[model samples]
Target: MNAPNIRPDIRFVWLNVHGGTFHKLIRLHERLRDSGLSCEVLFSVGPPRGLKLGVDVPLERVPELAARGVHFLGRTEVLNRAEKSPARLTVTDAHHDPDLPRLVRGLRARGHITAQMATLLGDFCHHGAEHLLMQHPLTLFFEMDYNHTPEGRGFAQAKTIQFTGNIFFEPTANRLVNDYPDREAFCARYGFDPARPLCLWLPNSCDARSETYGQVIEAVRGAGANLVVKLHPWEYAFKKHGGEHPWGLAATTDVLWSVQAVDETDGTWAYRFCDVAMVRGSATILELPFLEKPCVMLPLKEHVALFRAQANLVRTCCAALSDMRDLPPLLKNGPPAYSPQDYEAGRKSVRIDTTRDAYEQTMDALRQILSAPEELPVFGSLAPLRRMADPFVDASLIRTLTPSRRLRYLAARALRGICG
Candidate 1:
């Protein structure tokens, strides 16, 4: 097949992820191509992506970036006017910024399409109205929780479609099926006594107390279970959060496998491997009922509310009528302050019937807001949002410094977005 002719006109944006999101973006791109829409892809770059060269620390993609014309930009980085920003291929400048509109317009005149992935949901929603409105089809794609959108006017135009790519449940799902060290091997791997039950703790990065990992470990010990701890990747162990329990207690060698590396979804695989799971910051609370595995969630966290909400959804939506009866409540209230012996009870999640009806419903809802004879209200508002002091290019500030690295990072991220 011929490579989609690179044009200044058509531009598409893709969000990069380790798994499902990547494939889905490719699928979307393919769909656009098959429809004969002239288009180009603007790949949303992440942090320092290791390429063959020195490294692409960060760069933003542009209509004109290189001999190959693949532009690179930092992901949501804040440009400090304090220092002179880098050049166009690697940095933002008056020439590129002011000239960008002409460049994009040039690409459009050349008959190319432009699309983008909104990486940060909060910032995208709160700040990205103009950018979204600039494009024809602004899709918010993820298996995100239903509440990610604020129930107000701004959301009416953007077409939000959710696909989990199993990231949300992949960790838990992998744990359920992975070939693990037999009881003895797992014990040896993590240095727990084979005779004792292992209580595994995996916390999301932001909130320590909310994840309640400390309390879970204590509870497991209180319940007489051995411990294996996998911390949230974002938590800088050396940086003390109020002198909380020092992580010196968890011997790195004794850690079996951390969800940070092992499971990007909901940390379910990590939880499934352990006899008991203590968690904070992940949405895996809903997975336990279906897996029939036991899990503990930290209170005073948002998940505390999530669990309650899930429980209510299940109890009211599917109880008695379907197998997914108990899950809603388990997700809501959390397991009793104790262990559940069997899944024979009515509460549990059934298979995730990803069928035509569901897809239709999703599309219908999206089209209600996103469909357009001209421009969709939801997406047309995000262009100005991207032009902020920081666009989607240097979002996290990881690649904002060091011109060479930033450019490379942006290029690789853009390149990774091949339409499947």
Candidate 2:
């Protein structure tokens, strides 16, 4: 269905073109309405370019948001007629889109404020960082904390950065207070044994091998623990077969009997019930530390070096397993004892800002930008650098690279490093 007409007085437009982006944007929208903001806030959904790929709002979630009283807009409608439907500010998650720089330029020329919100922890080392660098000179860049600030990373666009705490924190905390189930209730809902230790497995989207999943299952069973496998959204949307298990797990009967697989977009509620978490170098692991849940790193061979380089703090603060066989022993032994001081230090490493509420800080930053949008200056030189480096990080191109093309990718990356 087509989005309804966008009112002229809308002050905030949130453009979401991916499920993950919508997840964050929706929570922020709810908070904005609850804060009693007088201005109009519209949630705009963009068309997905590929099949089950770039969809902004998942079909199932449309009614959910509508029930919450969020006004809707098709992004094309707003952008195509930018002058007629002017919003004081537009917000999007920090993601790579080839057309983003052009869109930002067009919107700014038409007197609209553009901002990107940080959705992931440790975004500097994630793909979003490369994307953020491409969209420099934004009216505002709402960073999660000090670790994500542009100046801390020596980026040229420091002036555009604002240190807001983790966007997921406040929403998740509220849910825990009001909606979370007790341990017994949670176990009963999922058919987990209340006595056995519960292990939550959050795997990366790229490595969904049946053999690896089988190994994890065996290790969990051997350790006498119950397993809950939370599939990443990509895995659920694209990787699953027409069966109860995702494509990789259909053949394993253990998945049917022993594992509980979940595909929900928001799985934070499960964190409180699980005793431990096992991950394959996903950013989701960063959230576990804040909850005081210990994690076991099960990095794949291809990602070991990258994981160590970017997530060393996670490896140090939590348990790291070099071999799958070691998982059984680690689970059986229970999570390593971490003092409050240890958890506090881990929180600092991820740059969690505790001084104010994240949603409030985000609203304050938006107000500041709307009041004085021209104060944020653009660095002309960095634009060319972004253009030059973008292709090296393009997700589609990287996925289809041949051996010869990979050499070129490496060469381009080296050149970008030297040039920067």
Candidate 3:
């Protein structure tokens, strides 16, 4: 069934593309609903597939998500570029959401984009629309990080509220931060161990970013490490014998097809196993030190302020990188403020109330935005998506796994003769 219409009095929640970032939004939605407020969500079917993209309906499970009285809107279907767009292999456009212009215009008129979606939302507070941002700490990422905040306003369009990293990405607690390998373990796992240091290259798999692949690939091949190009798991799927669509790579620098992926390509895990992790982001960079690895970053220029605003714990943890190459000239600018002392405190630390606190923060910000007569957010709200959500891992393999009854995680520790 089509999602219900947005109530006239409801606040409009604008989000960019939807994928892993939804982790926090999902949590907040449930909380907001219980409190009796409603919101609207905007997304495209598969990561902005439009010549210009608009909104998309999520999978059954996503809509079924208990977003606290939230209603999804702007659902439209476009070509699945991963398969349908033959022209997609070369030059492509991430601006397919043709409705985006309309969406932006509508949001601005509604007054939500002024604060929550667009950092500009702050400029529109008098209109009464509220934006809820689902932020992650991918220091270099665009869709879901600080680039949408006050600092990035000079360049990045303000359509979403800015939140911190951990909230968007949930990291595994330390299993003893192991050495991020630079050898063939990543290669051997995927069958390409020609024996160069393993250099893991993670790309922004969005179609909007296809134009930069050449630049990225050049950096990957030029870097002295073995090139293990791990495509974001969001858009593409790896295939072996014509199976396993939407999968990615191992630590090795080969594009070998696979029937299964460990969901392990996540930079947090790769940071522990790879020699030098190449990212266009701070998400992995922020978490790299726990594994004691260095990073090669792509300079996007929008993450600086967020770095300053992040909790000191996030800053302290990342300064340990072996080297910070990639944008040498830009080094004069410096990274966000993350203190090393705060690292130990945030790492492997779990706050059961973190989720609800984040939710209340977001809602409170929305309310503040509604009540404010000013344009910019006079005060930053809680970093809703920065806290890691609850996760269940398979004890036997130590791989992060979703909760389940069939695989039996609840009692498996006992089954293995280990006490929980």
Candidate 4:
């Protein structure tokens, strides 16, 4: 089979070999290739293998990625050819995946230009400042809007962060305004009636309060509202660890199970028809106003302090039900009048603007990055040497040699102790 005959000027490199994240990048690569660009995807290995996270599992979709004309390379392969490689640009969906910064640092050390396509719309609560501040210089960030969020500011401290809007929401504006799915069909598919109020509840997996999924579903159902529950991908991982919470069950016919189907249609299919939405801390809240749906932030006690900390920003857009019992009362009056100011504020906090075409902006940014001169890789103020050596230490060669999972665990612990 011939290579996709990609243009030499633009080469896309996707990192962090995982489930849906890898697939998302593959679709983007295909979209770019069809537009006459050279693209190859490299998956992360080495230290990622030593880690115990379920997202760190072996690459499962290489055949699919290959069929899309993406060249798949492991981290070791990338390192071996770095001294003589010709791909002037590298693109990734993850900047904070633990193994990624190290590999990115290596690629930059060899003078390859790097860029990150944010997986989320700058959901600030999910990441730490170091995830941004520690990357190499000259790395470009194609975020929604860099000036609005702390992550963007942190990236600005060390890299060229662009306000390209988020590519994830590029199709959102169209969906919300003109291309929304037919309400009757959506209702029938989810066992909901078009005339009845349908509530969509999204819960994150990080909190034990997630176990409240069952309670939340029951509450909404008892309130004379039909429900659609979408569980975070990590929630399944949680159940594997013996978190036999009720939300783990495959939802029944009455409730819509829209997990991982966001890309199957226009991403906002769930939000398009729902009368009201509920969220704990998921980024899906960012889409509520655009879809003209009112959202209520369920007051999960555990996340109350976080809400209080960012209350000014969060409450501006949605009603915060101080108690779960208030669900009926809040929805009794129908969806609240959405505040344009609140919506814009929420968008800024997450670095999203539905009006802008982020996909085109991102491609333009990549082209511009390719034309620029490479900057020397910068070291952190502290532990420059150790930080420089981190990629190799976490590289696949070291972890692959460990004979067993227990040994790998001990080796990782020992490495941390020594480095500290």
Candidate 5:
């Protein structure tokens, strides 16, 4: 695809590997422009084959971004143009992009600054090949908070890591407060009872057959609260591809009360209206405290083990359900109250900088990097040398594989002592 005609002296090239990252980048770009940073910005979306299910940025949004003086490009086109383009910096979210490490290295080699910003808390959790990117000496890493895990601390002390605030917080909060000012009107539009406590359930993409999902719905009903469910975008994509419906039997069958299933666009608004939230492996766990809403974590056994550090931190501050039966009483009694004091405490624990909003912090970081000497110095040691032979597999590859193929892949990796 031909690149859109814009200023050739692009100061920032933002690459988005996921739809969520794309939207967050848009927010940051808007802020930078509004703040009178006249530097040209180019937005690039990952190719369809490169992205996982449900994370592709919709093409309809491209024209709108273009109308705002942002040039949009395909992943391949951006990579090709980067070789000779006069862009001063290239920025991307710390998503599971298999090409990130190599791309960062290439850009840095060409005397351009490279940055990877964390859009979610999970971004701090380095797993498998991500360590390669995190440990790179030249690339700058921006995180939502001061990571508490051992791995996170090690990377922070070794690499060029900066503590930026949550990029989604201000935008989401402002939208909820300004766009949907009245909770009653918002509830009425959705046909939800404003009288009952509203519980928003944000499920992971792979939670199609989860038994806990049904239990949560029943628990909300038992507590006499209205339920709003927003499935991961991937779940909707899966359903379109003849996969199991996210609601399973509930999708076809009728229930006693309303189960309003909303799209991704309604997520932030729902967070504002809901009294409490039910989450499993969603970033909403970290975000809810900032909104002053307590969340109930319904962690699957595998997820807890995989994300042990995050699980421990969340379970420490929020209410986590070990037994499904306990959900009703907690919902009825209302989960532990999360106050401004609690938010401050949690902020300190995570080491998030709240003196200014995320957008301003990000802009400041960019200015600092841009004004730095062109000859950037290496900061970290030669640790990336040890993981040279690590089998670099895209996480999406594993997610898209058939059961048999997945088992075979795991077996192959196990033979090489890479699979845990």
Candidate 6:
């Protein structure tokens, strides 16, 4: 329960729709609530008509949150202009949400601070929305660590950007070190054979590039390993929008596929139990070294060029296989042996500094920001242009324009192709 007789003067609003990130947001909310701040979780399904990109519905946790004295705001009520209030602070784990700019502008219009607590750790260049959002004056971009948040890298110089440390990963690392669950017990709970070696297949949103997940699972099972599959929230988002259908696990093997069991929501339970892990292009591949676990990555044909260009550090960390035929041999030999140099490169790339406590530093930052006297945020270079464009291109109208969706997607694809 919340501390008795304490009222929150500062409010932290969590507006994340991704199931994976929602887990971290919940932990962050608890940390702040314990610190005596008023916390409200604003949950949503994701951008309408755009890529849904998230696997979980955050609004479902309302009753659970109410039981603990934390307030939960549904998406409709939160988005309704009639009932909206300028929160003292609004925070999110995702920048991909199309409505985020509107929400941020609304909060800042009334002199509130808006922050983006990034969910994944990687080169920020891979995420275009972050570049656009961080350029805004009222925004504060929180990085995984000091190295990730360098100065004058196209972000607003006047706004506050800090290496608040990795709130999600650091706590997860601490838990894995001090309070690890029993591997056998976890296996039993998930109905996996405790005796067999388990491999975790964590695929990102675009897993349908070369081969379907069913084909991948068949190859993994042929390697004499039990597999645990956790689809990225982005994949779920795509599925919800009537995208490609995911594979059924029963035909491949009695693979464990429970959302609660595999998703590191409560803590890093899945990684603790698995002997080896695999990914295509996930930041989680970068994090495995911190846990001292070996990871294997198989890049699809379509994404191979992009990965080669953007994911050099990730390649250094994991053993890259050409195809499914090569997986069994690698699995038989156990996780790859990384040199000291490889470990350093992976740590440096993701900025996983276990020396500092991210939760403490983040909470401290929040406290300081809230206690400081309020001032209206200074506008960035694009504020005038954004103000003029806001009325014309609001989210409500964009959602209703089904005729233009194809053109928008095509234009975006063409732009990306040209930029690349």
lDDT for each of the candidates?
0.33, 0.53, 0.36, 0.48, 0.54, 0.50
**TM-scores, one per candidate:** 0.40, 0.68, 0.41, 0.60, 0.69, 0.65
Clashes of each: 82, 0, 58, 2, 0, 0
Candidate 3 lDDT (Cα, 0 to 1): 0.36
Count: clashes, candidate 3 = 58
What value does the lDDT take at residue 365 in candidate 6? 64
lDDT tens readout by residue for model 6, 1-420: 121222334444444455444445556668887877776554454333221222332345445665553443444544542126544655544444455556665666666565656555433321211212221111221121112233223343224444455665542522311333587766776677888887887765455343545656766677777777766554444444544434432211112322222533312667767778887766577567666667787755554543443345445667777776777777776768777677566655445343455677677666666665555243353333223223323233233223465356346435545654
lDDT of 3 by residue, 155-239 (tens): 2233233342233334432121122354344445555454555555665432123434454445444543345555553333222
The digit string of per-residue lDDT tens for model 1 on 234-334 reads 22222212234333333221132222223222133345556655444444444444444565544433434334443332232212112223323443343
Alpha-carbon runs more than 4 Å astray in model 6: 1-10, 45-64, 67-69, 80-83, 122-154, 170-181, 212-215, 237-268, 309-311, 314-316, 322-324, 338-345, 371-420
- Against the true structure, what is every candidate's RMSD? 15.8, 8.3, 18.4, 12.3, 9.4, 10.7
By lDDT, who's the top model here? 5
Best by TM-score: 5
lDDT of 4 by residue, 1-420 (tens): 123333344444443332323444445555677777776654443333211122333245345455655554555564443324546665555434454556466766765666665545433211221222111111121121211234433432333434455555432422211244487876666567678787777766433334456666667666677777655544432333334443555542123332222322223566666777888766556545445567787775554433343333445677876777776667655767776777666555444334545566566666666665555333333233323323323223223222463364345547766877
* Rank ordering of all candidates by TM-score, starting from the highest: 5, 2, 6, 4, 3, 1
| Pairs in clash, predicted candidate 6 | none
Q: Give one digit per residue, the lDDT tens place, for model 5 in 258-279.
A: 3557544456678778888887
Off by over 4 Å in 1: 1-153, 159-167, 171-187, 204-213, 236-268, 287-292, 298-307, 310-420
**What's the TM for model 6?**
0.65
Ranking by lDDT: 5, 2, 6, 4, 3, 1
